[model samples]
Target: MEVELKLLLSPADNDKLLQHPLIAAHARAPVRTQQLSARYFDTPDLHLLRHGAGLRVRKIDGTWMQTMKAGGSVQSGLHRRNEWEGPVDRPWPRLGKLRKLIGDQQQWLDVLAADDLKARLEPLFVVAVERHTWDLDVDGNHIELVLDHGHIERHGRHVPINEVELELKDGDPASLFAFALRLQEQVPLRLSNTNKAERGYMLCRQTGTVPCRAQGLQLAPDATAADARLAILNNCLQHIQRNETAVIEGDDAETLHQMRVGVRRLRSALKLFEAAAPCPPALLEDIVWLGTELGAARDWDVLLASTLAHIQATPGGRSGVLDLQALALKAAHAKRSEAAQALLSQRYTRLLLTMGCWMQQPAPEGLEEPAQDFANRIMKRLHKKLLKRAQRMDESEPASIHRTRIAAKRARYALEFFHSLYGGKALRTYLKTLSSTQEQLGSHNDLVVADRLLRELNQQHDAAAATIQFARGYLQALQTSRTPDLGAIRAALHALRLP
Candidate 1:
């Protein structure tokens, strides 16, 4: 297994990094520089990629080495993957050597033995870098820090790379992050999960930007609450960081929404595990602040795309629809820009470091209970709170219903986090019903928020007043048209038996 943390730096930061006092003070020997060229191989259809594996052969100095990396989890910037490497005499990959390591694993054997497998292997991309390596003893841990400057090339096209990898040679993995955080104070760095091979694969396939969804969690049956909480937090953080580029570089609404969802999920996890490992209030506030920044943009996007579209389709509402849409879109774009800037700010970087540090800390004493037991207690508590709020749904007040919606959402998120632990028809049914109820309540809440926003916009833009009035009326009508089926929601809530 190879464990390392990767951080990306701007090209300008490269020179400053070499002169930094920290680097000079910790160096055990003079920095060693070498040229490295690697060629990645895969089948025409990307068989290895689908199986979460990467194969590459590189020439360093005058020696050739082949490496195989597969199946691993990435949390923040840290990557822990199964890696096998050995020196070879030639430039071509020696797949048979890797095969020997796998023994008789049938699945792997079948893929390795596919007809023309060796023949089909083609050079996907070339990574050529000038690597600078330093061996440092940080707090008694042996750490190897390597800085690579080069490009990933494919068919004459290339993407520049200026990144640092801190591999743990010996001792605690936590030290890697600690060193990273300290180094971050002098140089701006972003946590990067995109490995060299992944960038090559993307370039080879000419892949475009796409929204990142949450990856499923795989937990053991006997995992403890602390274990589950850490896994859930890691999953949420990955979702947020994975979509960072798409959210900032591309104007993809879904990506922004997913990013916001990731933030919400992280906040929810913090609350869910509060009893076991309470997050600092300051950290919680920062998370909330970032979420609000993201939400401002996302809320407008929903109104412009969905709610406004619905209003435009209604009679008498189409008169000023175009004008209103133009104004809303302008505002939405501005908010998105603001949200993107927030992501790039130093505050956001510090927040990531804070959360990373918190994650490495030991769980509180009380969190050692089995996950199943913890899930049962937490689920029942959240469900009861949700039910109590639902009981007041008959009031039909916007504020009251909004509160219910929030409760439902929290309960639903809790269910989702623990669903894998207790999977059955009942859990599925409960989730389905909860989803339906949450959607209905969410729509109602959107109307309430939309009306308020329209009123505010109406005050600012005299030309949009008529359009805002029309929108408010349409939203009220829509809200009245679809009442939430509270009775059915209650029935589902009651039917759920805590596992």
Candidate 2:
């Protein structure tokens, strides 16, 4: 297994990193440089990619080496993957050698033998890099820091590479993050989940930004609460980091929304597992801070894209809707830009590093209890709390209803995190009902938020005051027209059985 953390850097930052005092002070040996050229291979249909594998043959210092990397998980730039490598005599991939490494792993054997796989394999793209490596022993932990500079080329097109990788040679994973965070103070570094082969594949296929989706969780039946909690957190971080590029560079609203969702899920997980695996109050506060930053931009996006559009299509709604939308959208776009910039900020980077380091440490005491037992206790309490809140939905004020929505959301997230343990047709039915009620409550809450934002817009911009006023009135009427069926929602909540 190969354990490493990959950080993206600009050309200037790369230079600054080399001269950084920490690198100079901690160097265990003189820096060594190597010129590496690797050619990735896959079937025309991307069979290996489909199986979560990558194959490449590289020439380094007049020797050929073939490497295969199998399934792995990446969280907050740290990659843990199964890798096999051996010297090769030819440039083409030696599938036989890779197959031998599989060593009677039935699944891999099947994949390797599928439909004349060897004959179908072809070179995809070439990655050439001048790598400068530094071996360091920081407080007894051995680490290898490498700076890779070059380009990935395919069909005469190329993309520059300026990345730093911190591979753990022999040490606790926490040390790697600590070192990376120290370097981040001197150089602008972005946590990157993309590997060289993935980049090469993207270039080969001319692929565009791919929005990330919530990953499914798979937990063993006898797993402990700590095991499940760590898995959930890892998945959340991966979703957030995987979509970072799309959120920042592709300007995709969905990607940004998914990233925000990831943060929310993490916060929810922290709360859900509090009894078993308590999180630091400071860490919780930091996560909430990040979520707020993401929410500000996403709230505006929902208002402009969905709420405003709906109003503009209604009767007497088009008169001033576009003007109001234009003004609000201008401000919303500014907020989104600010949010994007925050993702690249050192503060945010530190949060990721801190979270990664925390995850590597041991879980709190009670979390060693069986996962099902812990989940049952937690879910029952959440469901009861949600039911109590649901009872007052009709008579409660808007603030109360909003609180109900949040309760429902938390309960829903808890159910999702533990769904695999109690999965059944009944559980699915309960989830569907919960989802419906949650959506209605959420829509109501959105309207409440939108009203406040429109009022703020009216107060902030004198020129758009009249249009904003019109919007507020329209929004009020819309909110008045769509009364939530609280009775139905309450009944659904009552019907839910603890899974």
Candidate 3:
């Protein structure tokens, strides 16, 4: 297994990091510099990448080496993955040699030694860089820190690769984050979510990023509560990071929505485990700030798509509300820009790095309970509380119902995190009913937002006064007439069982 934390460095600060005092103070050996030029290979269609694998043959300091990295998870820029590396006699990869190194490991042997695979392999991109490395002893923990600076090239296109990788050699993983935090005091670094191989492929493919949905996680039946918590939180972070790319690289409102959902899911997961696995309240606060930023754009997006379209369908409403539509879209666009900038901000990177560090901490001894038992206890309490709150939706105002909606959403997120610990049929049905209730509440919540937004615009967009008045009146009437899905919410709560 390869355990490393990857960070991006500014080329201008490359020398700054090299001269950082800690690198020398904790150095176990003199820093070594090498010229590394690697040729990455895959099928024309990238079959290896599809299966979560990367293959490369590199010449480092005049010696050729072959390496394969596969099936890794990158969370908050920390990567944990399976790696197989060995010397090769020549510059080209010898598949048969790689298979022999597999040494009867059937899982990867089947992947590396497939018939006709070697023949189909083609060089995809070349990664050329100057790598300077150090073996360090920090508080008795052994680490290998390397700085690689150069570019990835395919055909005539290229992207710079100036990154620092801290690989755990013989110690605790937390030391890597600790050392990184110290280094950041002297030099600014961004936690790199993308590795060299992935970057090389991205350069080769020249593909655009789209919004990524929350990934599903499967917990072992025998897993511990700590295990489930770590897995789910990492999954949530991955969800947010993927959509972060979408928002940063593309112009899709859905990306913000999905990223907001990821934030909310993460918050709920932290609350669910608060008793056992507590996180710093400051971390939670930072996340709430992020959610608020994302929600601004998301609310406008919903108002434009759902409420405005409904008002547009009414008699003469199309011509009446046209100005409001333009105002809403303009507001949405502005908020989207702000949200994207938030992702690029230093505060955001600090939050991710801190959360990633927190994830590295070992679970408290008291919290090391079995997954199923802990899940049932936590879940039953959540279900009962939700049922109690939801039963009052029959008489509550939109404000109170909005509270219930928040509760339902949190409950829904918790249910997803624990889904793998229970049986399929009953949980699936409960989840479907719960989903329906949340969606229905969500639809109603849109009216609340639309009303507030239009009121704000009524104060600002003076040229569209009549249009704003019409839209606000339309949403006001809709909210006044709307009813909560008492039956479905109650049914969802009822269907949720203790097991």
Candidate 4:
């Protein structure tokens, strides 16, 4: 297995990194440059790629090498995967020998060993670059900092590749992220989840982005809090990064919403695992910043779409609703752009790197207990706290209701993290009701925000006053009509049962 962290930056910023003092400060050897070119191969239908594998033959230093990579997890910019590399007589894969490199990976071996697949394999894309590398040891951890400026060209479409790979040859995995965070202060780097092979395929196929949701964390039965914390946090990072491209390139409202969910999930995980999983205060503050940024866009989107539709349905309300809708959509678009740029900014990248580095910390003392036990204690306390908060819910006191809603949300997130560990009909029933209560609270909150937003617009732009007045009246009516049933929610809370 190989561990490495890859970062992307602009070609202009490339020189900024070349002169960064860290390079010379820790260099174990003089910087070396090489001209390299690699040709990726895939069957006509992309058999290997579809089966979670990639084959490439590269020429560097007048030597040819064949490599195969598959089955890896990418968390926040860090890559850990199995890699097999060896000399090849020419720039062509020698399947007979290379297939053996992926030993015990029977499924992958079978795909490569097929004679028909080999016959159909052909160069699909070419990646050519000028690579500069320095060998450095930070705290005794050996790292190869590689800077590649190149492009991947296929069928006349070229995708630029100006990136750095911090390949860890010998060191603790956390050290890699530690070095990355330090280097980030000097260079504006974006943590990349896509590998070169995958990038080539995307460029060649022009594959579109799709929204990503959190995947299941099937923790082992014997896993401890230490193991579970890392797994849960890694899942959150993947969820956030996966939706990143979708939110940027696609306008599907749901796509950006999912990305926001990813952010909230991470914050929730850190709180639930508390002692076992800790993050720097600065990082936590940045996460709160990110959530607010994403929330602004989401709010506008919902107001323009969901909320406006409801206003239109209100039996008898009128006055420039259409005009207000137009303005809301424009604001939503602007907010959406701002949100996308945040994802592309250096500050956002730094947030991920800092969090990733912090995540690598060793398990704190006293967290060595089994995950099941840890989860039981945390959930019990959380459930009790939520019940106490629920008992305070009051229609007259919207503040109290919001507090209860927040408690419900936190409790729900905690339950979700441990759902797989203790699955049963009882757990399902509780979670379903809890979700219902949280959503109900959210609907109430939305009306309150809508009213405030419309009033603000009315104060800012005189031309919008008439329409805003009508909108505010309609919003107030909606709020009055749906008085949140605190009794029902309290009933659900009192019946709380932990799985």
Candidate 5:
């Protein structure tokens, strides 16, 4: 996730802005209030959310203060300064003040609106601070409290995290640097320049993923390896069952998508591990079937987005471009619907039962699986080799990087497959970088795949042909631009000592 450091200054504090180096224009004017909401999302363990909402008042002095806000926060919610403004001192007693207004069981809802702003606020910097947040219900409507103190404590797949945000909810970008400079001294805790939402997402995406059974055991003994492998496979299957339950219950798209990705990765890891310790042919077959069905929809969603993006970006010159693009999009949606339907079928349940029964049997004696430390070591070794291979392939033959990336991804998955057992801050950090790099390469690869599909569309018009050519060129250019400095990224990955 990205972090940021924020300094908020309201209209009342506008004159204070004159103390700063950046407030030359607004020496007499006050910062205006504009409506804004920032939400933070996370699980109890802080694995999923560390987000918030803010209605900021910005001054020319580079300070921006948060005001009463509305809307849903990702993990944190409804933290506005007006609520915190009483006779309270710095780091106001938020929970105490909040509880006095509304009890723990009732949730509060407020609609805040303001309109008076100029400035795109683009090319902005995110100022953040580490802070702990509680996801409990305050007065029933889910309320998260973000304290002034930046605190993070890792437990299982969650953590205690916080943030300090800085931005003019009214869309002004001036005074950011100057405000940051001032806040650096007033705030007692270490200031962070990261976006909590981005940081939390990266943390969740990289860390806190449940592990597979294969990750828990060493592939040393034939019998023990077999038992451990099956155990991991069952665990992976159980992960699927858990996620499937959420999907069946109509979980949000993001959560469901996360679960779906887990299912696919676990299934893939199990298949690879099972190569050494073969599972029942029938059991393996069932797992593959589920993965394929789910993967089809997921893959289609990814492809469709790219295709639509391409067509949308095209100029007004191409004839029949709309028709071909429509056909491709329709095909993708159809595939997604079909896959979703298949996942909800009775056969999926039967497969789930079969897999569950397999996981229930007791462990064989002296199984003595591989240690977590050892497995992590192997994963890192594989990651380093694969990364080098990816860079090497980038220069010589990009085609080969595809396979090399898959190998690195597999290793990363193998490690993350047991995200529950060895999850922590460092591991989370590595996984975050790994996943980001993987995504960039993966997106590049997706464009390559999409190009192949477009080339196969068999369009005939000269205009259509030209459009296709332009689209392919656009994709190629995008791919080139996305390929970042892999060496430095790799170094950063290495810096994170994975366990």
Candidate 6:
């Protein structure tokens, strides 16, 4: 692969007016440069190739350009960049020809746009050099880097975060470290050595919200459909495991959210494969335990953050915002850090070990049922349990919504686990309803917890009760809104055709 250097500069750098502290100290710029290129290959179904490392995969359909790369390793935590190109109708047989067709293009760049129009953060940008690229799984996620240069195109995403450059190309560590130090002192910034993906994986795993993937393990039936299905399952498991670890370690909040996603994916996968590959009851119990624990932390975190943001955005709320925010921050950090550590302690280790052992055990046989028939049986059984749980909810009980929310989750998970076999428009429709139910309940639950935590924090910090009064009011309003949503959910649940 041919080599080139890359740098991420602030928009203010348009006049080359920016100065890094390290660069100023050294009388030189800390800007990074490297040589890199790649090419890609993939099946029509996007079966083998997906998105690049630490980047989100938008969908699974049509042609996805595989990436390959060879370049100077950068010192930063950045890994060599990989990419999954946009959708194409080209089939597997024509991949080489298609790649050759695009080989001579001059540039390639993908910019993830700002996530929100009015958000505080700047947009994120990712630039790539296209060359000989092959899409393959590395450590679970789809990876594509330079093989040979065909053409390079820069795609941009409008997101909330501003110019953050990840020197994914191989380069010098000293150079990267020097760059980081320079950036930190020169500007108000959150400098991260860890890429988004790794941190996210760790958070999920530590919190028990996601199942961790066991390394050095391989599934049988390599040539069969089971191999593909199993691979996805394991990927989800490992992602959750890593995310959980991150949470316990007090890594970034985004990591925790990603981990939650892994949990949901795994739960969904289990539901999808319920008939084709059923897990044991004991194993299911452990997975459920992991979900509840992680979900507790995740739910609270989201609720507090959102509510805090909501307050800050308002005029009256902003008047006493700093004081209230400081107290909220203190409480949030305490709960988050404490929860994280609790999940990673020896007790949690025992839980993980136990779950690992269970995964190693054999699952019940599929009883020779047709793949679809088997899948349906699993779905109906699981869905029935969800309905049973939902039925247990009582309007008189204070925690009734919370209990039913858990049921909604299980129902959604049941559908996800069986997606490979039972996945269809109908199943999707049912899951959509159940998912909305869970979200409504979850939002209410988050407000409750946030309110209590905010109040406690206020008392600890000697803040007046009136300052934190909004939290209580918010929680009550949330409850009232959810009451109707919950009813709608129950009605929709009855409309689902689980069988």
Which candidate model has the greater lDDT, 2 or 5? 2
lDDT of 5 by residue, 386-489 (tens): 66665565533567657656765776677665454465786777677767767756766777677766675446344456666766777777667766566675
lDDT score of model 3? 0.84
Residue-level lDDT of model 4, residues 134-184, one tens digit each, is 999899999999999999999888889999999999988788888887888
In terms of TM-score, how similar is model 6 to the real structure?
0.48
Q: Where does model 3 exceed 4 Å of error?
A: 318-320, 394-396, 495-499
**Candidate 2 TM-score to native:** 0.96
Q: Quantify how close model 6 is to the true structure by its C-alpha RMSD in Å.
A: 15.6
Cα-based TM-score, every candidate = 0.94, 0.96, 0.94, 0.95, 0.46, 0.48
TM-score of model number 5: 0.46
> Residue 262: error of model 4 in Å?
1.2
Residue 78 of model 4 has an lDDT of 83
Q: Per-residue alpha-carbon lDDT of model 6 for 190-267, expressed as tens digits?
A: 222233332233332333333343233233322233543455465666666556546765446666776667666666
Cα lDDT listed for each candidate: 0.85, 0.85, 0.84, 0.86, 0.45, 0.47
Off by over 4 Å in 6: 1-235, 242-251, 261-296, 335-354, 362-371, 388-396
Better of 2 and 4 by TM-score: 2
In model 4, which range of ten residues has the least summed lDDT? 272-281
lDDT of 2: 0.85
Span of 10 residues, lowest total lDDT, candidate 1: 490-499
C-alpha lDDT of candidate 1 relative to the true structure: 0.85
What ordering of candidates by TM-score runs from best to worst?
A: 2, 4, 3, 1, 6, 5
Q: Count of backbone clashes for each model?
A: 0, 0, 0, 0, 56, 102
